[model samples]
Target chain A: MNSRISAFLADRLPLKNVENHIKKPLPKHINWLFSLGSMAAFLLILQAVTGAFLAFYYSPSPDHAYDAVNYISKEVLFGGFVRGLHHWGASVLVIVVFLHLLRVVAYASYKPPREMTWVTGVLMLLIVLGFGFTGYLLPWDQKAYWATVVGVKIAGTAPVIGDFVAKVLRGGEEVGAVTLTRFYALHTIWLPWLAFGLIAVHLFFVRYYGSAGTPKNTPEDMRSGKPFYPDQLFEDAVAILILFIVLASMAIFVPVPLEELADPTDASYDPRPEWYFLFLFQLLKYFEGPLEVVGTFVIPTVGFVLLLFLPFLDRKEERTSLLKRPVALTVTCLSVVLIMLLTILGAIAPRLEPVPEQPPAAEQTAPSQETPEKAEEEAVFDFGLD
Target chain B: MTDVPEEGQQRRTFFKIGMAAIGGLIGLAMAIPLVGFAISPAFRKASKKWVDLGIADLLKGSRYKKINYTFSAKDGWVETNKRRSVYVTDQGDGTFQVYSRVCSHLGCLVRWDEGKDQFFCPCHGAVFDSAGNVVAGPPPRPMDKLPVKVEDGILYVKES
Candidate 1:
């Protein structure tokens, strides 16, 4: 029976060709750090699978979005667990992708033939962030509404075409039903398609050029490289198993929470972006008024552009070690430190003042008789909104 | 090594091109309706209807009275009965002006401040006078006034 199956596969599929690709020798220096990329890929698959289940019941309108999510979590079988996986999986994917990038930089792996691979990886990271941003609004809760308002407003601070861009993003002047629908479409359909295509290209490049050997490895280690099928594949499988256990444990212990349904007319809610965006949020605090555009757009754009073209910029042939590449190492260290510092600051920043309690309706009458000075003293305005 | 015949090489190239073309055509065919279904919500228009609030006399004098009205909204395959509120202030001249409780600046509900004699938004500190003019805070405009009518002493509001 096994022979018959093998014969059927050999006749229809390129089994031998696939075997030739999978059985290539991998560098001996490949270790746990090298598994980050594969871990991220595993998380993406988890997200797609869990997200498909979520999309089955999610309603993308202002009226029913919140309730649908509630129904899914409380009513649907194992839906809360699936959602927790997707939520935590998204965050973990971001962290793993960042770590993968860091590992590549630390080993000077984005040199020469690996430049295209690095570029595709960067695009994937951006796509992951896009997923986070779009998915945040899917729950249609208070945090989603207010955070998205601030996010779109930040986009509106761009020079020349900021208003146009913001309008296009919102589908109107405000984040309404249309905005929810648009975000839902982008999150569930467009972004995933883009991610899948980019990931395919990224994997193809990895297969074509092979993993960049660690500069820390000796010549003897390079000569004693092992076949990927059993050795490296075993490491990858073990790492993935560990990741699944950790993610499942997290899902079981601390499931994702749902907030109150979005009330656009209520201004009392505090609005803050997701943790990954906290650095940019903190940066915006330092550059207010006319210079807001600098923090919101220019700095991040320039920094990312520089990082994207780092291979071309640092065109040295011999220096592939961290110690040898002082400039690159310093830049990487500084960027990581700056981002961490800003994120910490943003997290600890004071929240907007809470909405003052109102007197019970039964006991109150029109304050038409109050003195202007007393009324002024009693009035509370939202500082964050301004 | 001996090179393959020119005719065989050309045939292989043609076969590869034809296979890719056929595959692409199939992919396009499959994608059309799937993509259309995925993005169908973007093209849907929000259905709005005029809901009756009942009894214009419920709103009398200069006082703001909160009233709840529910209407069904259809979006794609989901139909939801959305309950919304509006504060109707009687002008004392037999004319009624209905204000959406939603603050003008961001979409927070605005409450009438009996002590301050104005509509105050707790979310952003936007203050509006009894006549619905922005007096202080970040509100770019006054409170939104809904299109309201009184036909045979019955109040009706246009809501989406």
Candidate 2:
């Protein structure tokens, strides 16, 4: 073989590298659960690549944004496909991540030495959430705008520093140019860079420790252990294949959500969080009334803290958290409450009612019969846009 | 799904742990609106945008003039009243010229002097020709013009 091929075979980054790094056999009994890591990686890569492409066409303006993206879908080559790819990629990333997280949890993988990895994993989850938040604003349509309104409002619920938090996020008391510019910068540049760095550290430690052994037992014979070779490669390849099919199928069929032009002044519009946030959205409802703090910062905040502290809390000798019933049960109970609360709150949240303002613009109304509710419903004061 | 303990570990004290969890979840459930309601207003401050005044006949041909107007703006919680002024003239075509009534030097309001046929910024010894160009003063640049757009018979000028 040529020297180039020889060098290529020397690394583990490519299939060619598999030749140089050939070693003992893998666990012949490896299951679908073991393949989730590669699948998550596949999805994350897709999100980053597709997100970069979509960024080129997306306008971060409250006024022209919807039209700008619409123009791309109609005008730019493959714009719709790329946008679809991005949309599905986000969902894929979240799903795959959760699966990866669960696989680790289910296997009782967050043991000693792997503690840092566990903490980093939680950070990765938060980064995914951050990605979701910032990306929502990129479209700048009514849905995105109002969703942001609710988001900022929720953040405002942060106790003593509520207004300050809101202002810091908004660059003022409300979302506008300043907010758009900040989110755009943070989304495209800041957060991604940080995520990439954190991911590198996270992955380095993961590999440094070796692919975690499954809960049952470690093999005594070295030959029985899996090498990061053909066996793993085959599974990873299969995972990539499955990921592609799912993303493509969703992209082709499910038209991405597109809202009307961004009208922050449109009071009737209700803002809801993205699907991933739906669970948390549902949680707030139960926290309503006297226990508002529990809904606001207390619960989700505590859950997030628990997620971070999992490594410290679950430091047991067993493999599956199943081995340590109490700790596992506690975490499980927390997750259940978190998800259940989210569901209830989401169901209960009154559709957002814009603070009653002056009526809608006359131009928005049809020349036909203008009924009172239609007048009321359609009537909105101009927040001053062309 | 709640985490299920191992089959072997499922026995004993189910009620105790269950009750504590139920309480914790309930407590969190109660805190939502107390936070949502309060933070919402402070979270909502105000939004403002520059209004495009279609066209106002506030300008007279090549003459120093002071035009005054008041307008209302919705600022989240309050409607703010605004005041504006400008000196107007004819700038080629159908467009008329407009300039700040405030002097370019120190922003003191300027006045039209029919006697010299010029604009005078009395507070700082500043002077301007009829076209609202600074004749002599500590001004760094010429007087700023407000954007004007005329639609129908009404003339409106930019608030900025």
Which parts of model 2 are misplaced by more than 4 Å? A4-29, A219-223, A321-327, A337-341, A344-386, B1-160
What TM value does model 1 have?
0.67
Q: What's candidate 2's DockQ score?
A: 0.01
DockQ score of the complex predicted as candidate 1:
0.02
lDDT of 2 by residue, B1-160 (tens): 3456453134224433543554454334323422332234355444534444334444435454456667787432234687877766666576766677877787798888889978888897888877667788777777777776666745567775
Please name the candidate that would achieve the greatest TM-score relative to the true structure.
1
Q: What is the Cα-based lDDT of residue B60 in candidate 2?
A: 33
Kindly give the stretch of ten consecutive residues in candidate 1 chain A with the minimal lDDT sum.
A377-386
**Overall lDDT per candidate, in order of appearance:** 0.80, 0.69
Candidate 1 lDDT tens digits, A1-386: 99999999999999998987777777777778888888888889878977886787798999889988887676555666667878888888888989999998989888878899988988888889989998999999988898899899888988889999899999999999999999999998999999999999999998888887788667566545665665566566567767877787787688687889888777677777889999998999898778888999899888888878878887985537777788887888899999999999999999887665664343245567768886665555323321
| Candidate 1 Cα outliers beyond 4 Å, as residue runs | A218-223, A355-386, B1-160
After TM-score superposition, the amount by which residue B6's alpha carbon in candidate 1 deviates from its true location, in angstroms, is 48
TM-score of chain B of 1: 0.76
